[model samples]
Target: MALPTLDDPFYYLANFHTVLDWLGSRYADLLSAEERDFIAAFEALPRASRALLVRMVMRKGVDFRASRLRYAEIGDTRAAAAPLIAAGWVETDAELELAALFTLATKGELAADLAPWLAELGLSRSAGKAAWCAALAAESPAPRALPAWLPSLDDTHYRLTVDALGERFRLMFFGNLRQQWSEFVLADLGIYRFESVSLAASSRAFSRRDELEAYHHLHRCRERFDADEPLADLLAEIPREPFDNPWLERRRGRLLYKFAYRSERQGELRQALALYHDSAAPEARLRRIRVLERLARFDEAWALARCAENAPVSAAETQALGRIVPRLRRKLGLPRGAAAAPAEPERIMLTLPRSGWVEGAVAAHLSRDQAPVIYVENTLINALFGLLCWEAIFAPLPGAFFHPFHSGPADLFDEDFHARRQALFAACLAALERGDYADIVRRRFRDKHGIQSPFVAWGALDERTLALALTCIPARHLRLWFERLLGDIRANRAGMPDLIQFWPDEARYRMIEVKGPGDRLQDNQKRWLAFCAEHAMPVSVCYVSWDEGGDERERQDAQGDEGQPQGAVIEDAGAPPNSAAGGNPA
Candidate 1:
């Protein structure tokens, strides 16, 4: 469908209309009576009225100052709003509480409107708005309309009464509240582009209206939790029973996990344990085990850890269980179980001159004329994999995609993400074994440049880097990394080595994990290192120390280093050997 051009004065209106039509066609069974009536009434309204309502809905707040609602295209705000107000879609008398009043009125207006209240409390007129609001908050005045609060002000407050309804529509369209209406504007302006996926009638975020309501409910709970609401009150409201829908269940589980995590932090172990038990979030089980161990309930933790080990929710959970299970066994005086982790990657010790970023310093120290080192923390491999598996990742599965502007499939991190497209992913991976993987990757990189994917970092994976990676990296290594990624896309997508050095002539590459002073390998990084070691991939951990005497020289070098190639200095103190055969690259 063609988006409305910005040249059109009612572009937003046109976009809103498009959304309404799409929702009506796709979610006809899911819309409530109220939502259906709203759509019909909205479509029947005058163009100006519809535009005015759309403007208010698209804006930041529900309450809008009529005098401030000036648009050249939408002449006479009062006339435009008259029909909306008549239709009960806009309210002239919105009860603004003290905080809402503070938000709506300017500082001068506040001082004038609350002159008597401020004077009664002896608040200085010169005081800041926050100070005035804080002082007036103690008075606890009832909420009042603008006219009631400011008798002399000649302005009507056009509060869009249908904001919640509009948000529901928005939620239906974008599948989440995080994406705003500006997406349409961005798409229209060519600032953002989306792949044209065929959204089948069956492809939608919510299968039923109840699922939509559950999502909305969870969203509000998350908001309340973020707003610092009382945990006990929120816990009481949060549904302990899991939703039949996995998507909604995942969301609920995530929110419960947060609440449990907060409770654990607050030393409420019992509360946290209970919440974690109720949560179906993937991490909740591991957390529950940790909390049990913390509470000295070794038996319970051991039992749960064993169950989780038998049927692991994810690779990450299994990895954590390996650690927790062993410790719990020792605490319980049980026989040692859990297998040994893979050997760590080769270690390289370097004492380089202090420079800007530690990774940059390491890259410069290790890079050679023949072998170029790049600081690709997590981008290179992910980009290569994303390019190779473009088809599998963007496979138009039911519930995977429903909207046009999705950066990636909605179920990218879901448990069944890989299972659903196992065959498609197998076909993609087969190219890696068929000696045609590089060609496929290169083609995808050229064809799908700048189109959003969860894995591809477009800015980082330039042509030069892609070419070097494709030439030097072996297909076997790519397959291993891609397999690990598909194992747990949410967890394994990150924590790659900080830098990669490529030898195009030798068709060899080495991944380097750099550690600065006081920096240590994170858990995810450790997992990645172990994975590389187990797979016999060339990887190393670089321990860097600063040369105290070269501080001044390092500063000087940094300033004049703009045009210099990476690792320009061949003889720096403690620099890695120039030859690839020097063993550890350091």
Candidate 2:
């Protein structure tokens, strides 16, 4: 049977199952041991019970009403939830109630929504706590007395114990815990001190709050990093507290890597190199190599490239070294007699009016010709590459210690590595499989359910478009192409063609880069164009120039050598004057 359309409820249903399958299989490692155990227990239940459990778990808040579970397909809701309730995952009849004083405190915000009810009760309209208390005393339901297991406190509230807090932390750490009850509870407590006076007075009152405090520190560091703080200041002031966990280590490494990255961007190569040495992030190492080259330390860069090429941790790293080595050899004035060249390079380069003009014109032209064209540039390609090497991109490694923010998929380097080559190959193969690519892509982006991936914003393409792309691009070719593209995922992920034209029926696609008036190709764009040319990937650079409209004054200016547009469009023609072989100097 065919898949359902995007608007169909069955589509969401099927996609939900797909997410579950991915969680159960691909992301099993992300869950804690306890979470895995809970999943195992869930699987062991009867089908209806399992469904009900899933519904409960996926539900928004902690205290859902019994009426909310009355879904027709899950049979008797109470019977279905029997196992969960017995397992202490759910509780009933021991409901908590708000104090009269608390109600009086929040009566203003509540009164707006309950205006009709308030008016029906003939309560005072005055905005005073005394009036609110008086009205509540007359009409409010009596607070229930505490059961034997509960504390008999009337004026005070309860707080989560350290163990309970830790449990919640674990859930948040694993992406399962949510800020549901805390959102309302914190908002309701105006200025109350609920914990014991003794605990509050003690120096170790919040000793067990180390994990939470560490996470808070990590967040502060992230903010400072985002604000572009100096590497020296950041190194000195960033959190030194250690959680001794793999996740925290990864997070700390990622933060340090960010500092190094900022240094590199600011042209402080020596300082950046020093910072890179402290990180195990692949991007840092790759940057170090590039910085060495920029500093004209070719021999050092060459040595590092040789070592990385021999033992790459990820496919992206290996691919980067492959490109770097060749370029380094060229930079060192090595001969290229043995390397094959295009017999007759027939790639095209055209002159348009402006950079913006090139994109719109090319996109419109391609769309008019029955081709689905998208201005993906970096977002789509990077996202695809990221997913294909997610494991390597987020793999934890030893680094100079900083604090607790375990690097997740946010960091894409191994010190200088990109992705594990073998795993990348596997991912590409999986991507080519029928239904797998769509499922994986949808699941990753949480399409139609959660946060959608901005990458897949390509127009006129959905799961159908991706399926067609896999058929055309194929796993093997896609693997080879992406491997060559990852010279440095950090750098190569950008400067891609501004437009992509895909012909679904023909199963063909071409990338087009746009250049405006007086604009020239950047180093990265030249490298990408050269790579495409070498591998027979259809790509072009459209140089946009202002149209003169045959005006005499404009014609005079246009006649000048500087004003005249240069470059030829090769349409099944012989090699142009400056072919791809001679074009890219990067």
Candidate 3:
């Protein structure tokens, strides 16, 4: 469908109308009486009134100064606002608190208007807006209309009374409040392009009005929490029982986890422990263990850690537990279990002149005539995986896709994300085993080019890099990486080695992780290194040091670093194919 052009003065109105039409048709069964009446009454209003309301809705605040509500298309703002005022959608007499008044009026305007009151309070004109607001705030002035507060001022304020209703409509359309009315504008402007997914009649965000209400309730709670509301009050309002809807439940769980983390930070260990116990968040168990340990409840922490170790929720949890469990066991006077140390990857030590990006400098140092290095940190492998599993990732299962603007499935990070699309993924991965993976990936790259995706970094994955990766990286290695990604996508999708050196003639590749001085490996990076070692994949860590004394020499080397002397191999600690340099898996 062609989007409405910005040239049309009513483009925003058209976008809003599009949402209403979509909701009225697809979510008729779910609409409340208020919503239905709103749609009917809104359509009955004059085009100018509707356009004026949309303008306010798309803006930052509900309170709009009538003098500033100027639109050539909506001539005579008062005439356009009359119908909205009658419908109670736009309020001319809405009460404004002192803070709100401060927001609407200029400092000079407030100083002039409130001069008498300020004189009575002995506040000087030199006082800034904050000082004036503070002085007025102490008086506990009653909320009144803008005109009433500043009787001498000529301006009038119009508040959009149905701002909350408009937000609800937006939530229904976008499935989340994070995305706003600008999505339509962005889409029309060609700044964003989404895949055209066929949405069925049943394809709507909320299946029931209660679900909508629950989502709204959770949204309100989130807003309050973000506003730094009292944690105890927020907790009391949050429903203890989980929502039946998995999506809503996840939201509630994450919110609970956030509150628990805040409580922990505030030194309320018991409160944090209780909230963590109640939350269904994936990392709640680990947090609970940590909170318990903080409270010096060693036995409980130990027991929970053991249980979590037995059935870890994710690789991250397992990795954390490995450290926590041992400490807890030692604290409990249990004998330390001897564990084999993980094999360390080969290390390269370089003393090069400080250049631009460390990774690019390393790439230059490593690239050969037969072997070219590409800096692809976390992009190449992810892009390939995305291309191979494009269909599986975008499979139009119920609840997976509700809108055409979705870059990927809504449940991409859900626990059952992989399980739900198990068959589809299995089919996609089968191409790897069948030796037809390259063809499928190439086809997807060609067909789905320029389409928004969660994994494909289109700007980074050029045709040359793609061809080189497909040629150098083996199918078995790709399968290993893909399977690991599926195991825990949210955890494993990142932390790939920074640079990849490919030998197309030998059909071989090596991934290199670059580290500048004083930089240590992150936990995720360590995990990737271990995974590579376990599979005997050719991988190495490159440690770089700047030659402070060799500045002139380094400057010369920077011009053509490929001809510069190579870095020394400091350590070859891991198993075979222990090369000091290598390429990425794209």
How many clashes show up in model 2?
29
Off by over 4 Å in 2: 1-215, 225-233, 238-246, 260-273, 286-346, 353-357, 366-455, 458-496, 502-507, 520-531, 550-586
Give the RMSD in angstroms, all C-alphas superposed, for model 3: 3.6
Q: How are the candidates ranked when ordered by lDDT, highest leading?
A: 3, 1, 2
Clash pairs detected, candidate 1: none
What lDDT would each prediction earn against the true structure?
Answer: 0.86, 0.51, 0.87
> On residues 1-586, what C-alpha lDDT tens digit does candidate 1 reach at each position?
7788999999999999999988998899999999999999988999999999999999998888998999989999999999999999998978888788788789887776678888889987888999998988887889989989887777888788899999999999889989999999999887777777878976778888988898899999999999999898999888878888888988999999999999999999999999998898888989999999999998888888889989998767877877787788789898997487578787777766677798998887677778899989999989998899988888899888988899899999998899999999999999988999888988998998888788887889889899999998888889999999998888898999999988887788888899988899888998899899887788888887777756566666678866543223433222244444223343
> How does candidate 1 score on lDDT?
0.86
Question: Worst ten-residue run, lDDT, model 2?
Answer: 196-205
Judging by TM-score, tell me the better candidate of 2 and 3.
3
Candidate 3, residues 1-586, lDDT tens digits: the string is: 3568988989999988888988987899988899999999999999999999999999988998998999999999989999999999988868999999999999888977799899999989988889889999999999999988888789889999898999999899889998888888888887787888778978988899899988999999999999999998888888899899889999999999999999999999998998998899999999999999998999999888889978999888888887888898888999997766886777777776677789998888667777789999999999999999998999999898887689888889998999999999999999998999999999999998888999998999999899999998999899999999999889898999999888887788888999998899998999999899788888889888876766566556556556345432223324333243343321
